[model samples]
Structure formats: structure tokens, C-alpha cells
Target: MRETGLLSLEAKKRHARTKIHGYYEGAFKFTRPVRLDDDCLSVYLIHVGGGYVDGDTYGSTITLGEGAELAVTSQASTKVYKTPSKPVEQHTKIHLGADSVLEYFLDPLILYEGARFIQNTTIEMEPDAVFFYSDIITPGWSKDGVNFRYDWVRNKLKVYQNGKLVLFDHLLLEPDDELEGVLQLEGHTHVGSFVLFHPEASREFAEWLYENVFESFPDVRLGISDMEGGGIVIRILGDRTQTIERILSHIHTFARRELLDKGEISWRKY
Candidate 1:
């Protein structure tokens, strides 16, 4: 069976609202939006039978008003199940106004054995706009019947400013594919990345992130590069989903307090 799910969030006048609309197995329709309490914006996902399963598609969009501030997070990691029919798909879109700020700290995505998934993220920003976003993916759950040898996941990210493309990221992973020659992965099963739209910052900050949070993980490889229009991209490859999630949370908190000068997101309490 094939299914589609839609999740969206929009911000205007510093007020953030979100909605989820879609059906699963043609038996039920899902609709709801968790409000952002303070700090910015956040949305909690709903689980079906304790997991997010096969033939599922989810898309979300977020917008920021001029001079407004917003933050978004997921209440839990997205779970992908294995089935013979099809894989799951996720898509996201974000927009930021001039002088506005957006920080998104998404939870990791867990892929089960025999599962295949594709995800895409697109961001549109105005000049002088600041934003931060990250994505993380983990291997199959080890405690259950799941295994890692047959799963696959792909991700694509694009950032634009003033209608001009600035940053493009394409990430793909499959057990059968031979990427051993490349410096990527290097025997790790979990991967995470952080992309920032701030050009005025120096290389010191990027270097610091690698030196501090990533210092202890020997199996993880780090990559830092310049994004179009003076932005920055940080990529990490590791073996543990919990480690990657922790690193992402650290970066998100630091960005919120140090970069945006706003406290931790209030909606997280709920």
C-alpha cells in the first residue's frame, strides 16, 4: 500500500503555527500542530503503532517574519520500518525574512533493515538573514530484529538567498554501494550535518565546533566548507545515533544562546 503525509509550519508576526495533514493505509487521517511556546517554533510528531512506517511521505514548511525569531525541533526521532512494498519519503521547506532568525534542531532518523528512504530540504533566505539547520541519520535499530546490511537513505539540501541558489548538499548511503574509495563514511553507520547561513563569522567558530564536540569520537570524520554567499556547512560521520543526536543538540543550544541571544526553546518543555 502507498501513503502520503504532510506536515507544515508557518510563522508570521512572531507567532508560529503548524499543521499535519495526511492519511495512512486509507484507514485514518492525521491533523494537528503543536504550538511553539517561546524562543521560536517547534513541532512534535505522531507515531503509528510505535513507529513511522513504509510507504509514508512527510513534508513540512516554515516561515519567519521580518525581525522575528523562530526555532523548530522534533519531539522524537523518526522511525522508519521495513516492508516489501515501499520506502518512506520526507521533504521540508523553510523561509526567512530580512533580519529574521531561524534555528532548527531536528531529531535523528532511524532506519530499519530492508528499509529505503529519501529526504529533501530547501531553504530560502533574504540577504542579511541568519539561519541554522541540521540533519542526522542512523543505522538500523540493533536491539530488535532489525539489522543494518539492507537499509538505505538519501538526502538532498538546497539553500537560496534572494532567489539565487547558494548551498547544495547531496548525501546518499546504501549498503551495496561502494563508497570505500572516498573519504566519506570511513566505516561509520551514523551521519550528521549542520549548515549555517552566517558569512560574517570567522573560521574560528567552525574550528571550535570540531575541536570541542567532535574531539572524542575517533570513528567520526568531520568536514567544514564554505557555502554559497558566505555560509558554512559542517558534516560529521559517526557510529552511534545517540552520539550524533547529542552533538546536534549541543550545537543547537549554543547557537540559540550565543548566536540568537534567546533562551532555550520554551515549547520543548511540553
Candidate 2:
């Protein structure tokens, strides 16, 4: 079955809150907005079925009105179970108004053996809006105890500002034949990525991220670069999931405090 969800938030001066005006569908449910001391709304996306199954399709759309601030995260990592017949697919779309802020720092996606999945995310924002996004991919538990056993996995991310495309990132991993090849995992089992698109993301910030954040983690192979439209992109490869998660979390926390002027607020799902 196909499951769909939609959410729209607008800033209301009457109560100084970003209220959710539109919501639809099930399985892809969201909790009530939690007001943070930083005046930003935090919403958690919950998968009612717990994980993805064969032939399952899910879609979600989120929009932020002008001057609105919102932080979105998932209740837990997206688990992709074994699918023999068909692959599960998920699509997400985001829109940001002028001067709005959006933080989408979600958990990783774990793929079990025989699991096949595809994910596509598109973002359109105004010139002055701020956007932060991060994602990770890790191998799930297998009976054979071998890593990178998944059949196929694909992820695509596209970003646009003021109707001009600025970033397009794509990744495809099929570890059936050559798992240790240089073009594949390159002997790494886990991969993670982080992106920040804001007006203040200068080359200096990129250098600072490489020196301060990436340098702190000596085990992981990290790469940092500047995007076309004043954005920062980071890629990481590691053997342990916890190590990669910690590095990305630190970057997110630092960005929140420096760019959004907000203290780190933990999202407790358990």
C-alpha cells in the first residue's frame, strides 16, 4: 500500500508560534510541535509500522512559511527489512519561504540483507532561507554476519534557491559483486553526509568545518567542500556507526548554536 503525509507550518505573530496548518494521511504521523526556548518548533516524524516492507511506498511534504523556524527529525532510524519481490521507495519534498529556517537532522537508514530501497529528497527555498540536512547509511544485522550485504540502495538529493538549481547529490550502492572496490565502499561499511545552505556559509566556514569538526575525528575519512551557492557539503566514511553519528551530531549541534542562536535540544524517542 502507498502511504502519504503532508505538513505545512506558518508563523503567527498573534501567539509568536509556528502553527501547523495542514496535515494528512497516516503511518507517516508527526507529533505536536514542541516549543523550544529558542522560539523554534520541533516536530518528530513517526513511522507507525515501525519499518519498511516489500512494495511499500511512502511520501511526505513539508512547507515553512516566511519567517518561520522549524526543526524536524525522525523518531528512530528508518529500518529497511528484507524484500524479495519489490523494493520500498520513499520521497520527500520541502519548501522554505523567505528568511525561514529548517533543520532536518534525522537518524540513519539501516538496510538488512536482501533489502532494496530508493529515496529521493527535493528542496526549494527562497534566497534568504536557511537549510540544514544530514543523512547516514549503515548495514543492518545479518545472519551470515557479513557487512554490506544489501542488494541495492539509491539516494538522491536536490536543492534549489530562487528557482535556480544549486546542488545535486546522488549515490548508488550495489554491493553484490565488488564490495571492497575503490568505487564502492572502499573498505568502509558506513557512510554519512551533511549539508548546510545559508548565506553565511562562506569559504571560511568550510575551512573551519574541516579543521574543527572533521579534524577531531581522526578515524573517519572526511571530505568538506563549498557548494555553488554559498553552501557547505560534508562526506564521511567509517567502519562504526556510532563514530559517524557522533561526528554528524557534533556538526549539527555546532551549527544550531552558531547559525540559529539556539542551544542543542535532544529528541528522546525511547
Candidate 3:
């Protein structure tokens, strides 16, 4: 069966600040949002079921009205079990209006033996729209405790601004293939990526970000690249999931303090 979720928020200026004028939710569920000092709202995404099974299909659409700013994150990591017949499928589409902001940060994904999963994401933004996204992938357990035993994993991303495509990214990992090659995981068991799209993004900022965020993690092989218009993309490869997460934490701090200018943030999950 196909299950779909929807989320929409409109921004309204009041009390000398921006607030959500209206919002909508569908099949997807989220915890109550909390307002931050910068007028940005934070919300946590919830998966009704604990994990994904065979033939499971999930889709979500998100839209932010003009001037709106929102931050979203997953409550926990996503787990994908064996999919003998069909792979678990997920698709997400996001729309941002002028001067909008969105930060999508999700936990690691756990793929068990024989697991197969596919995910696709597309983003459409108008001018002056800022966006940040990051995710990690981890190998799940197997009978023999070996890593990379899954069937395969595929993730694709596309971003467009003013009806012009600015970025396109695709990733695929198969355990049966050689993962220790120079162009592959390079003996790493975990992988992650961070994407930042903002008008102020520049090579200098990317270098600064590398120095501030990636230099601290010696165990991880990191790379940063520039986008066509103005943005940066970060690639992270690490041996342990914890290390990757630690890098992500630093990246988050950098983003909030430097990019979003909201200072340190806490989900209050504790």
C-alpha cells in the first residue's frame, strides 16, 4: 500500500517577529513545535511504526510559505529490515517561498541483512530561500556480525531555484560490490552527507567550515565542494556511526551559529 504524509506552514509577522499563521498535517505525525528566540519553529518527525518492512512505501510533501522558517528532525533512526520481494521506498518533495528557511536533519539509517531501500527527494525554492540538510547511513546487524551485508541502498536528490536546476545528487551502495575501493567507502563502515544552499554560501565559507568542522575529525575522510550558483556540499566517511554523528553535531552547531545565527540548539529530547 502507498502511504503519504503532508506538511505545510505559512509565515505571518506579528509582535515584531515571524510566527506560523497556519499549518497542516496529514498521514505524517509530528510533535508539538517549540518557538526559538530567532522566530524559528522546531519540530520532530515521528514514524508511527518502529521500522520498515518489505514492500513498504512512504511519501511526504512539505511546503513553507513566504518568509517562513522551520527546522525539522526525526525522533529516531530509521530501521529497514529484509525485503526479499520488493524494496522499501520513500519519496519527499519540498517547496520553499521567497526568503524562507528550512533545516532537515535526520538520524542515521540502519539497514539489516538482505535489506533494500530507495529514497528520492526534490526541492523547489524561490529567490533568497535558505536550506540545510544532512543524513547518515549505518550498517545493521547480521547473523555473522559482518558489515555491508545488505542487498542495496539508493538515494537521490534534486534541487531547483527559480525553475532552474541547481543540484542533482545520487548515491547507491551494494554490499556485494567492492566497498573498499578508492572511490567507495574506502574501508569505512558508515557514510554521511551535508548540503547547504544559501545566497551567502561561498568558497571562503566552505573553507572556513572545513577548518572549523572537519579538521577536528581525523578519523573521518571529509570533502567539500561548491555548487553552481552559490552553495556547498559536504561528504563524510567514517568507520563508526558515533564518529559520523559527532561530526554532524559539530556541523549542526556551525550551521546554527554561523548560518542560521540562532546559536546553540537543543531538541529537548533529553
Best by TM-score: 2
Ranked candidates, highest TM-score first? 2, 3, 1
Q: Please list the C-alpha lDDT of all candidates, in the order they appear.
A: 0.68, 0.83, 0.81
lDDT of 2: 0.83
Cα lDDT over the full model 3: 0.81
Give the top-scoring candidate (lDDT).
Answer: 2
Q: Give the per-residue lDDT digits (tens) of candidate 1, residues 1-270.
A: 233555455556523432223333332222244455534444444444456576777666677767666566666677787856877777788888887777777677778777788888898999788888888877765666443644778888988999998877889887754543366676666789888876554477666656666655554577777644657787877777777766766666665665667655554534
Relative to the true structure, candidate 2 reaches a TM of 0.93
Candidate 2: regions farther than 4 A off: 1-15
What TM-score would every model get versus the actual structure? 0.79, 0.93, 0.91
